[model samples]
Target: MGVQKEKLVQVPRIENGIGLMAGFDIRVIQEFADESLRATSQDDIVEKFRKESRQFGFDYFVALSLCDLADPPEDVVWVDQSPKGWDQIYIKNDFQNVDPYFAAAVKQRLPFVWSDCLDRVQRSKGVAQPTHDMLDEAASFGYGDGISIPMLIPGTHRGCVSLTGERPDLSQGPRHTIHLMAIYLFEACLRINKSALREWKAKEFIALTDREKHTLQLLGSGLNASDISEVLKVSEPTVRYYIKNAKQKLGANNVTHAVAKAMLYGHIEI
Candidate 1:
């Protein structure tokens, strides 16, 4: 008998209830102890996601323009606020002090739902009423409500994702949905960012000489010069010579640095 045709499974339409005025942007930032050790091409990664977000109905998506690895200031205007043309406002008026969303996101390391901004007086203490006025101004631009999700990589503090929109009635359900999407988007971005970093490091290391490359491979394998000499059938002095030359070519202060650079460049596994 012919296989029975399977019935079409019904799929429920999951509505986020987020209108055109609501949208999100994810920002990933990582800092290596050595500035040279930094990983991730943030611009390329952001561009990649900006394209993807369009398929998901995002009205607009942007990558935060990061200048340093330091955690962004709590009230940095463009860093926290949404709505077109805020970049000019942030730059011209210096709205950092009055932006509540940015302050809450950095301080709490939690998402700042738009509804949370309703407690105006309590949230804007000490700051000038102008700051509150600035927020009210932003609300006029379809950003009255939103959420900011802090994306913390294990060793980093500056990574975060911000979701914003004009939906005044964004309840727990839509909030959770946006939060979940932001988490997934940020996770993917992290992977791509790291991969790009590794590639760049590998390219930089690949420019080493043949002798340097050999020395790095042996060192990465945990072999001493004497052991390397025996393995490569060269004299101990010759092995030491090669190691020294490799270190110089790699601009390494020591054998350890050479090995680390080699591993970073995909020249050696160890």
Candidate 2:
């Protein structure tokens, strides 16, 4: 997904004020940011982000460049890693038109949850019933809970990073960590060569066997090991073996990350 062509007001520059930011570990955040900046490829950035973010229980991540609302940039960056079916549902329903988080990202410079922004929007001026209904539908697709962090970078359009899960660590500490991690990760993604990204990912595809690729595709489609075993006509342990091999080959920390990498890079499709 990328920026919409519609023209809007530009986001104002704001400084990150001082605070204890007690909820997150500064050391971990620093390490993650450093690692992200050093990443040579988009895949490497996503891998590092997934490894750190999953610790807080998030299942998906999306970063969008809300390029200078005054004028859509020539090149807009959008990165989405989510569960199966959610993307199709989002696009089919056109949720972006009514999404409050997008507005909040442009106007505010802080991290906020979906409900927080919805409530604020409702209080200022009531939104249509469709907004509520759209969110309800999103929850059914595993975006039951989520947080959005505004990414304010100079000389570029405003950006936002959103993470979703059934129940994620949204406490102050984890929020701080996630906020910093997302900012650096998005910046790193912006610096990569967008056109060459596919070629880089394609190079990795040669390492995955057909069975491993199939296993990841099924995993991305929301099947458990047992279900995949039945469908593949193999034992549960065999399914796990395939997953483990795929993870190692992909340099992923777990099955979910492996599946995300495979799906994001076009190694497999659900």
Candidate 3:
């Protein structure tokens, strides 16, 4: 239900020759971070981020927020600025389920390099073929190398902003700077997207009936339909009806998705 993942590491800048350039780039990261935070639109933020990425050496990118991947790939909001052809193929192939980067994000707590995805592929049995194929196809699009930064905004849904294609000389400076940039880009877009969504009327969002709300609350808390029926002294089918109605009201794809949407829209607290 999250974005990119990898354990990001920051090491000392002690290289006599290369350290200078790395130091300069690392410091400039703060400058971009400032600009990103104040960005009001997805386009502006992505434009600035892409320009900066080229300066550091990268081509394609994907900024995504996955609230619950169990639903469908298109269920979450994502900023996909990668090549046009890649998007079509990727979505058509249903590759998200097998993408190593996404799998890593679910388990990893740190930003990771592209190679880390391969490492994950190697560790998982029978998964190597799909991972390899995905990478092989991505390489055809010139996105053979890049960085993945899984973003976590406390109390918010998990997200990721990634830079793909071309390699940035890691020895140039603190790798954490890359992670920081990825996070800033994702967050800027999040704010812009959310601002539009925040205009939704609270009354319309919480259209569920009292019974529906209670049913959803219990469901979100991990109670099953049968349990809820017993607790409410209603038939199992009646409980299902309420849950189904709540899912429709929330525009959710499943039980978990409905729960997440209810929480996000302030309809219910979990």
Candidate 4:
């Protein structure tokens, strides 16, 4: 088996003055497939999405690790392909106090509208941000009027696709159509990622022993070899021996590779 690069489909543009204002930026990043399988480079994939986003009129574009879910300020645009001189302060701070819509979408594995979130705000108060600062920022960026779609692959990771604009009333118009287009685009990207992962796993050969598997499980939870040895009640040398054996068995070049393979094979969870 070899690595396969899944093709992504182009999403249609939404019909509205504001909907047309912000463009669709799509990126699919597969680090495991890229490094292990040597299928596609991260830089090449990012550039492809960047070009698509520009052609579609997206104001910003980014491809990141879905598992990290770090809550950074919105104004601190991690992707430089955005409009400059905007209200960076408010954008950066707005999502700080609220439950990230992207996070919610990923967890639920479904497409969600901003309206669905706002309507359910009362129930989502705890998980969602409820700061006046967020509201003020929303007003500034017109974020209240947008759509969010979650992209998830079974037995894999999750991603989010969001489209925002200044349009306040997206109930029944071009804004809704644009949101639909974005959803289709996100779905295509998700399929591509899924296919790539499957292909990469097929070509990769990594195995682990029972003892090494247990050790890796502990290590994934931020445990050192000494700590793992203490919990397992095994000698430090025994633990090292198991790790070495597992590394050789899995064809891992190092300890980190061994751990990664263990996790991928369900021998360890991260």
Candidate 5:
């Protein structure tokens, strides 16, 4: 059996974001950010994020950095604490394309809660699908309430951190404080990852999202972007996005260059 998640200690809820903004221990937050930024690897960065996030009443969190805009990858560069079963079903169904929160995060440059997105979906005309299904599926895994904080990394990529579980006593202030923390955590993630970046020059390995990996595999099998789009059931633009994003991450000049680097790094066989 999996270990049970710990309940958060109660804190007084203050309105208008005053309590968290004015009273949150900025010192401790800065300290964690400093430590995380100094971390040596991706694993270390995730450990720091998990530890710090839980202190803010987040039961579980998943951090993501989207590398491409046209055809964004789901579940990319993320650290998740959800149950294995939940994740298994998610991957099996390719739900990332339809994940309401992810879709919102990619477009909006703001912080929002899961319910906020759900309501927007409900209020819109000709909505893509049911808002209840999205929230209900999450609740099935014990995630009834949650928040998603999205960030735009200057000159690099867009990232987000999603927290879920038993609703903590978060007021306006506390929520804002956590939002700032996500930025710091993402900075640290990039820092550590940069040092270990799998560049064509260095021949080191870099992390790729599951979608990116699959795309690479398909390309290795002599598939073009159009063919890959049909195979993945995604748009052709998305296939291009995956290819370009992989190319950039591998520090290659083009698709062929990226594939060669991937082979050199043993990420795929051709």
Candidate 6:
């Protein structure tokens, strides 16, 4: 069966302030978080995510660890619940080289729908023809628009949780809620694979103020100090001060290093 696009309608925006979870069902998010915290194994996390994904209209998902891997690695933390035979075709064609979603995942820090990223990539110069070809092939297997939540790991490694189907909710409320869930699920995956957590050894949890954490998150999302200041409605100097304070607390050599450590320590979400 071929995938079908869902017609989107403009919905009234929920009037919730930033840093609040007023629009979505907090109980459901909390329940998922509690369940994720209790998950002791990779299988547990996978099962939990699978069950919850359907609520948002996704039938297939891939929780991938993107490093220097040219091919899929044999690791427990990497979960692939994508369509059957998609992997075989992906490997045969070396689609990894031109997979637009993977290309976007490493650069993006927030959850984004596939079409948005694809459109951006298409508009860019020097885009490969195979990128579009690969996506068309995916649609042949009932894969259509989906969401990819990008996670910036401590080291060079990045992570992405993508949910795909013929049609899924693309509204802001679901996007925001899924971002929260993806954070917890990624943490569970890290917990299941102890080897992955070795380098991120336990240290005294440096407490960062809410503003500081929010500043680092915006920074991680590729915002400059001025951009962050504008977003937070603060002066540029205040934004720089928050970055400086966070850097000192994390004992980082620079702002980028501080953001990386903050992500590693779970002090902020990107």
Give the top-scoring candidate (lDDT): 6
Worst ten in a row by lDDT for model 6: 195-204
Q: What lDDT is reached at residue 221 by model 3?
A: 82
Q: Put down candidate 5 lDDT per residue, 35-134, tens digits, no spaces.
A: 7666777777677766666665677777767544235453235556776577667656666766888889888888888777877876884346544465
Clashes of 6: 0
Superior candidate under lDDT, 1 versus 3: 3
Ranking by lDDT: 6, 2, 3, 5, 1, 4
What are the runs in model 2 whose C-alpha is more than 4 Å off? Answer: 1-23, 67-74, 194-270
Residues 133-238 of candidate 6: C-alpha lDDT, one tens digit per residue: 9988999988878999998767435788888888877677777777788888987887776644543452346778999999999999999999999999999999
| Model 3 lDDT tens row, 160-238 | 7667765654443435666778778877787777675664554465688889888989998889999999999999999
lDDT of each: 0.56, 0.80, 0.75, 0.53, 0.72, 0.81
lDDT-best of 5 and 6: 6
* 1-270: candidate 2 lDDT, tens digit per residue: 357766686885665755456557778788887887788788888878887888888889888787433344545567778778776776777766777887687788889987777777889998888788877887887775778998887866678899988888888777878888998988888777444555575555548888889989999989999999999999999999999998998789988889887876678877
In candidate 5, list every pair of residues with a backbone clash: 17-172, 17-173
User: Which residue ranges in model 5 land beyond 4 Å of their true spot?
Assistant: 1-23, 67-76, 126-131, 199-201, 204-270
lDDT (10s digit) by residue, model 4, range 165-190? 44433444334444444444444444
TM-scores for every predicted model:
0.48, 0.60, 0.61, 0.38, 0.59, 0.61
Scored against the true structure, residue 146 in model 2 reaches a CA lDDT of: 78
Q: Which stretches of candidate 4 lie over 4 Å from their true place?
A: 1-65, 69-97, 123-129, 168-184, 187-270
TM-score (C-alpha) between model 3 and the true structure: 0.61
The alpha-carbon RMSD values of the candidates against the true structure, listed in the order shown, are 12.1, 17.1, 13.9, 14.8, 17.0, 18.5
